[model samples]
Target chain A: MSDAATQPDSYPVTDRSRVKRLHERGRYDHAAVHAILDAAMVAHIAYVIDGQPFCTPTAFWREGTHLYWHGSAASRMLRAQKPGLPVCLTVTHLDSLVLARCGFNHSVDYRSAMCFGTAHIIEDLEAKARALDAMIDRFYPGRNAELRPSTAQEIKATMVVGMEIEEASAKIRSKGVGDEEEDYALPIYAARIPVTQVIGAPEPCPRLVDGVAFPEGLKGFTAGRRLDEVMVESHRTTFGVE
Target chain B: MSDAATQPDSYPVTDRSRVKRLHERGRYDHAAVHAILDAAMVAHIAYVIDGQPFCTPTAFWREGTHLYWHGSAASRMLRAQKPGLPVCLTVTHLDSLVLARCGFNHSVDYRSAMCFGTAHIIEDLEAKARALDAMIDRFYPGRNAELRPSTAQEIKATMVVGMEIEEASAKIRSKGVGDEEEDYALPIYAARIPVTQVIGAPEPCPRLVDGVAFPEGLKGFTAGRRLDEVMVESHRTTFGVE
Candidate 1:
C-alpha cells in the first residue's frame, strides 16, 4: 500500500518542501508553520487512491507537532488514510484583495500553510477522549466541563487520526501591490480591500432553557471583532504566533 | 500522461461522487455544484505527482462549468497538472460553529463543493486573455478597463490552466446541532456562533494619483454583509437560488 517514491520525509527546503515561485515568502520553521495551523479553523486534506486525488475540508486541531481530525467511524476517506499512508493538510486565510494599476500585478494578501506527513489512526479510547477534550477546549475555552460526556456508543462510532508533520512550510504575502514601473503613472484607482472573518452575536438555540445566560466563553463579545482574534482569545493562549 | 484509473468520469452519486457519511446532505445536480463553485473565491487544488498528493490553495473562477486558475509559468505544481492529469478542486465556507449539549454532536455548519476533473493547459492567447479579463472583471467589475492592459511579456510569463469538471458534488449542513435524545436535559449553553467574512474600508495606496475617487463598485457597501453575498454581487446575475 506504500511506494518509496510517494513516501514523505522531512528535509529542509531541498525536496518537495521548496518554494520555487516566490522563495522570499517561504518559511521553513516550526514556529511559522504552527502559527498558521493554530489560527486556522479548518483544513483542506488531500489523499490519493488509485492515482486519483481527493481534497476534503474538515476541522482540525494541533498539539505539539501532531495534527488530529475526527470523523464518523465509517468514513471512506478516513479509512483510506491509515498509518503509513501519505497525506497533505493545507490551511489558508485570504487576508485581502489587492487592486493594482496593471491587471497582471493584481493579487491577494494571504497566509497559507502546507504540511506533508503520514497518518496513524488513534484507537486508544483514553487518548482519543483526551484529544477530543483538548480540541473542544481549544475552540471554546472551559467548555468541556459544561458539556455532557460522550456516551460509549458515541465514542465507538468516532474515528480519530493523528498525523505527525514531517515536512511543512508557511507562505505569506502581506504587502501592497507591486505594479510595473510604467503603470504607476496611469490614472487608476489602486488600493487594498481588506478582508477578514467576523463573528456575529451569538444566537441561542430556540430550545434553550428559559434562564440560560450567555456562557462565559462569549463575554463582551461583539459583532465586529476579527474572527481570528476571537478564536485566539477563545482559549486565552497563543499557538503559532511569535 | 493519463491513466484509465486516473480519468475523472461523470456519474451521479453512484460511484466516486457519492457522499457516504452524511448521504442526505449531498447534491448531485449541476445546479448545486455550479452554485457552490460560483460562490467560492479560492479552491484547494489537489494533484498527484510520482504517487504523492499536493494540495495548493489558489484563486479560481468558474465559467460555464469550467474552472480556471492562472499562475507563474515556472510553477512546479502547474507543470505536473498538464492535460489529462486527474485533479480534485474543493471549495468550502464555514458558516457557523454549533455547540451541542453533547460533545459528539458539536459541529460546524458549512457549504463545500468537491470537483473531479482533468486539467488542460490554455495555450491559445485569445482564450487565455479572455479568461483573465473575465476573472479580473468578476472580482472587480468595471475596473479592468481603467487599468493598464497587460504587457505581452507579462502574459507570456503567466500560465493558465482549465479543468473541465467531470464529476462534482455539493454538501451543505446549514442548521443547528444534532444532540442525542438524552442530552437535551443538560444545563449546557448551546448556541450557534455565526461566522462571516467582512470587507473593511478600502485603503488607497499612499502613492495614488490625486483626485482618484472611490470606484463605483463599492458604493453603499456595509460591513456586516456576508462575504459570499459580496462576492456574488461583485459579478451580478444569479445561479441556483430560487
Candidate 2:
C-alpha cells in the first residue's frame, strides 16, 4: 500500500481550504499536501497589509507540517509577516500543456497546494540557525557542514519565519485532455506538450580555490534532470524519509 | 534605443508595489515589467476575502498594460474577484541557484514582477470572447484560427477577469555569486547551477483523428527549447513587436 493509504492522516476540511470547484481533484491528505510542497523550490506567500493583499515569491521548505521561509530582516514583507500574520502559501508545478480540438477544452496539467497558516518569526537564535542549516541541507544534503559557518552578524540580519499549516489542500490535474465526446471526431490535432524544469550545466565561480573539486552533496543535481524530481529526492535524502 | 527608453512610460511607485529591500534590483520601466510578465505562463494572484489572504496560481496573459486570467464560472475565486476586488499579481521565474561559500550569501537568480490592481470580471460577451482568443494567441500565435470556434455555452461557462496595471515593479537578479572578499579564499567549492523550464517531446492523444497533421502555429514549441523563451517569442509574434 502507498504511504498515504497506510498513514491515512488528513487535514480537516475547512471552508477556506476546501476545493469548491472540481472537487474530485482536491486532496487533503498529508502525503499529497507534503509531496506538492516539497517538490517546489519557491512558494508565493500572500498576506494582507492594511487591507491590501501582497503576494511575494520566496524560497521555502517544509518540515513535518510546518512551512519555513527566510529573507533579509529589513524586508518589508518579512517584517510585516513576523507578528503572526495570517497568510496563504501556495506552490504550483505546471506539468504540461494540454491542447484540445476546441479552445474550451484546452488545459494545463499541474500540481498545486494552498496552505493557510499564521506566520511568526523564529525568535530563538539557536533554533533559527538550525532552521537555516536545514534549509541548505534540504537542497544539498550534508553540504552545510562543509561550508563556512554563518557569522553572528549574518544570522542576525536574516529573519526566519515558520507557519504550522492549519488547513491545506492539494489540487492536481495529471490526465490527458477530456473533451466532449463528439469533439474527438474533429479533424483538428490534439496532443499534450510536457513542461519540465531542468538543471543546466554548472558554472564554477571564477574565484574558486585551486583544485577544489565539485561538492559531493550536489551530485544529485545532474544536467537534464527534472528539478522538482531532484528536489523531492534531495528532501528524502535530508529527512531520511521515503 | 530600447523601447522603454523611447516610450519612457512607467507605473507610479505606490506604497504597496515598491520594492523595499535591495532597491537597486527594482525596475519600474514598462519594458522591464512587461518582459517578465510576458515570459511567464502562470501568475500567483493574491486576494483577500474575510480578512484572510489567498494566493491562487492561474494561467495568465498580458495585453498592453492589463493582465487577464480566466477560470470556471463556478470557481469561488472568480466569484469573489468579480466585483472589483483588490489583488496583487506576481510572476516569478527561478533562473539559477547561487551557491556561495557562506549561507548568508546563498541566493537564487530570478526575474519577478509584482503588479497591484483591482480585478473585475469582463462582463460583455464580445469583449470576453476577444480576450479569450487573445489569450490563446498569446501562447500559440494563430492557433485559435485553426481550432473549432467556442460555442456560446462554453463562453458562458468561463469567467474572464482583467486588471489594469495601477502599480508595478520588476526585480531581477541575474549575476553570478558574490561571496565576501575574505571568504573567497576558503577551500569551499562554489558554483551556479542554472535552472530552466524546457519543452519535452509532445505526446499525441490516442483518439486524434486519422491523418490530422501537427498544426503549423505550434512550430515554435520545439523539444529541448526553453519554455519561457518560446513564450516570449510567441508573444512577440502575436503582438507584432520586437
Candidate 3:
C-alpha cells in the first residue's frame, strides 16, 4: 500500500530533515535503491521476539521496493509473531579504506541503505520457491535449471520472510575524507585506499568425480560470494518458518 | 556485578550449540575479542524504540568484553528507552567475497558479533567525557591532546550509551563453499576473492601552521572501511576522547 509518496511515520523519525546532509544524500530514486540493493549480498536484519531484541544475519535479494531474506524453520524472528512483525534491514558495502594523518581522521568509503517495514512470513510453497529461485539467479543466471531441486524436507525446514521497502534512505560517501580546502599543507598521509573486488583463480573441490573439470555452470564465476549464501540456504531446510 | 562465569545470561541466548559453529568460531577466546574489537571501527548498532525496531550506524570501541557505541543528542535509541530497556548491539566485518562454482554458492567471508542487553544512558558529563575518550583514544592515541576540549553545552547535546559485553559470541566464516564431493566436476567455479586491506600513501594537509608536519603520533595508523564513524563525531564536538 506504499509507493513514492511514502512518509516517515513508519520510521524512527518521519521528518526526513533530521537525516543530516540532505543534498549529498541519495533520496528515494530507483537507481539509488537498485544500485545499493543489487551490489549488496547480505542484509543485517534486526527485529524483536517477546521484549528481547534479536539481530539475525540472513541472505536477501531485492525485487522492486521489496526485500526477501530467509533463515531457519525454528528461528525466533520467523516464529515470534503471528502473521507478521516489524523489522529493519540494512546493507552496506565498503568501497575503500581512508588512511589519514591522524587516527581520529581515519575513515572509510562506503555505500549503505537502511530500510524499515513489517515482515510477512512468506508461507506459500510456490511463492517461497520462486523467491528462493530469484535469490539463486541474483548472482548466477539460469541457475535453477542447472541445480538439483529442493526436497520437501528442505522447504519445511526453511523460513522465508518478505518485507516491503517502504520508509528507506541510502547514505553514501565515496571519495576521500574532508581535508578542508586550506588544510592540504600539513605533512600528513591522506589517500583513498581503493578496495576492488577482483576474482581469484578458482579452487575446484577435491572430491569431484576425478578431473571432470568444472562444468559450464561455473565458467569464469567471479561473483561467488553473492552465490554462497543462496546455495547454503537453498540447501538448508525451512526449519522454523513452516 | 558481572563476570565471565555468569555473563552468558546477559545475552539473549546461552546455549553454545544454538549458534551453529560455536567453538572454531573466530571469537572463541579472549584474544579473539580483542582482535575483533580492535579490527572494527564502526558497528551496525541496533536498538528498539517505542516498541518498534530501529538500527542506527555508529562508531564503537571495545574495552575488555563490554562494548561502547553512541550517537547524536537526538538519537531515538538513547532518548526513547525507559530505564533498563533491552537493546541489541551487533558489529560485523565483511572480510572477503567468496566465489563458488554455482551461483547459489557465492558467499562473503566475515566475522560478526551480536550482544543482547539493557542500555544505560550516561547523564553525567565527567563520566560521559571519559567514556567518550575511551571510545576515541582507542583509535587515535595522542590526538585528543591536540584538539579543543568540549564545553558543557556540547556535552549535553550528545547522547552516549554504554553496554557491558557480558554475554556474547562472535561468529566467523573465512572459507569457501563446501560443495558435495561429486559436484566439483560439474564446472562450478569455486574459490575465494581474497580481500586485502592496505594503507595507501598519505597526503599531507596544505594549511599546516607553517612547517608543522604530520605529527610523530601519526605513525602506524591502522584504520579501515569499518571506521567511518567517530571521525564525523570527533569533528562535530570539541569533546576529544583521546
Candidate 4:
C-alpha cells in the first residue's frame, strides 16, 4: 500500500536512467524514487571539474519534484554546481547481509536510487530562506519557529541549489538469501542478518538553560523505530502523501 | 586504542585530498581513514566516461594498504574502472542527527572518508580468487570452507579492482549539538539522536534444508552491537590488531 506501488506517474527511462544489468529490480515511479530519496539523509553527489570526477557526501532534502542541498557559499562543490552542470546524486540503504550457501550468491539486500540532473543555484533570497526553513523543519518539525530568525548575513553566506530530477530510477532487493538448490542441501547455515538504523535516546546538550524541556515535536520519538520508518512517517504526516 | 590515533605515517595532503572547509575535522592517519573505510559496507564510486560523471554504489573491502571492490565482468562500473582510471571512492556513516537550538547550527554527526587514486584492474586469476575469498570471509568469517568452490567460468566473469591509497582523508564530527550562545535559552529540544545500524534476527531462507544449524560464528553474534563495533571486532580477531 505504499505510494510507490500505487502512484500512476512514472519516470521515463532513458539510456542513463535505465538499469541494464539488473532490469528486474528497476523501478521508475515517483513512489519508488521519492521514497528512497526522502528516506535517505545523505546523498553522494558526483560532478566533474576539469575531467576529474569528485563525489561529495552532503545532507540533502527533497521538495516537490526537485532535490536540494546546501553548503557554504565558498565551497567548491556549491560553486561548481551553481552553473547548472550535469550531476548525479545517489542514495543507498543497506538492509542486510545475505549469507548464501556459496560465496558467489552472497550479497547485501539494499535500496538505492540514482538521480541525474543539472543543478541551478537558488538566487532569490526569499526562496532560499524558505528552503533553509524547510530543511530544518524536515528533520525537527516546528523547529524553525522555535529557533532564532536567520540573519540576512547568515543567509548570504550559504548556498542552496536545486535540481529538477530530469531522470531518476530506484532499485531494491529485500528478499531472503537465495542459494543454489544443490548447495541448500549442504550442512551449512544460510540466513540473512537484517540491518536497520536505530535512533537512540536523545542526549541533551550540557549548555542548555534551566526549565527548558523536550518539545512536543520530540515526545513521539522512540529509540527502537527504524530510521526510514521515522523519516517516512514524518514526511507523510507533514506533507499528506504528496 | 584505534590505529588511526596511533599511526605515524600520514597521507600527504595533496591539493585534491585537502579538506579546506572545516579543516580542523580532517584526519589523514591510517586509523582515521581505514576505520571509516572498514566500517562502511558500501562506497560510492565516482568516475567520468565521455565527460559525464557517474556515481555508483557498490560494496567495498579493505586489505593491507589498498581498497578493493568487485562486480560482474560486464557491468559498466567494473568495465569502465578496470583500465586504471582516476576515481574517487567515498564511504560515509550517518552517526546521528544533531538538532541544534538554532536552524543554522543543525547538522548530522558522521564519519566519512574520500580516497583519490587510480584503480588497477586485478588480472591475476589466483589473486582475484583470493580477493574474492577474502571478501566473503570478511563479511562472514569461517564460512568459506563450507561452501562450494567458485568455478573457472564464475571467476572469469568477475572483475576485481584495487586502488592504492595514494591520498585519503577522513572527517568526523561526534560531539553534542552546539548552538549559538543567545539561542541556548530558547524553549526547544536541542539534542542528538544517535543512529546505529542494528542487526536483527537471522531469517533463514525457505529453501533451507532440515537439520542444518547455525554456525558458531553466527551464534556468538548479538543484535544490539553497533555495526562498526562488530566489523572492527571481526577485523581485530581475524587479523590481530595492526
Q: What is the TM-score of chain A, computed separately for every candidate?
A: 0.90, 0.96, 0.78, 0.94
Per candidate, the number of residue pairs that clash is 1, 0, 48, 2
Q: How do all the candidates rank in terms of TM-score, highest first?
A: 2, 4, 1, 3
Q: Is the docking of candidate 2 incorrect, acceptable, medium or high quality?
A: high
Give the per-residue lDDT of model 1 (tens digit) for B54-106. 99999988877788998988898888876567999999988888989878989
Candidate 2 fraction of reference contacts recovered: 0.95
**TM-scores for candidates 1 onward, in order:** 0.92, 0.97, 0.74, 0.94
Q: Write the per-residue lDDT of candidate 3 for residues A1-242, one digit (tens) a residue.
A: 22434543332334331245433554555555456666656677877766567675666877766888877676666776437888888776666656444333456677777787889988888888777767666644555565655656767667788888756767787757655444455454455554433334455545444544544544434442333333323323221111
* Best model per TM-score: 2
lDDT of 4 by residue, A67-183 (tens): 999988988888888768899999999999898887888898999999989989999999999999988777666668878788898899889989998788899998768876778
Worst 10 residues of 2 chain A by lDDT: A1-10
At residue A18, give the lDDT of candidate 3: 27
lDDT of 1 at A92: 94
Candidate RMSDs in order: 5.1, 3.1, 7.3, 3.6
The Cα RMSD across the true interface for model 1 is: 1.0
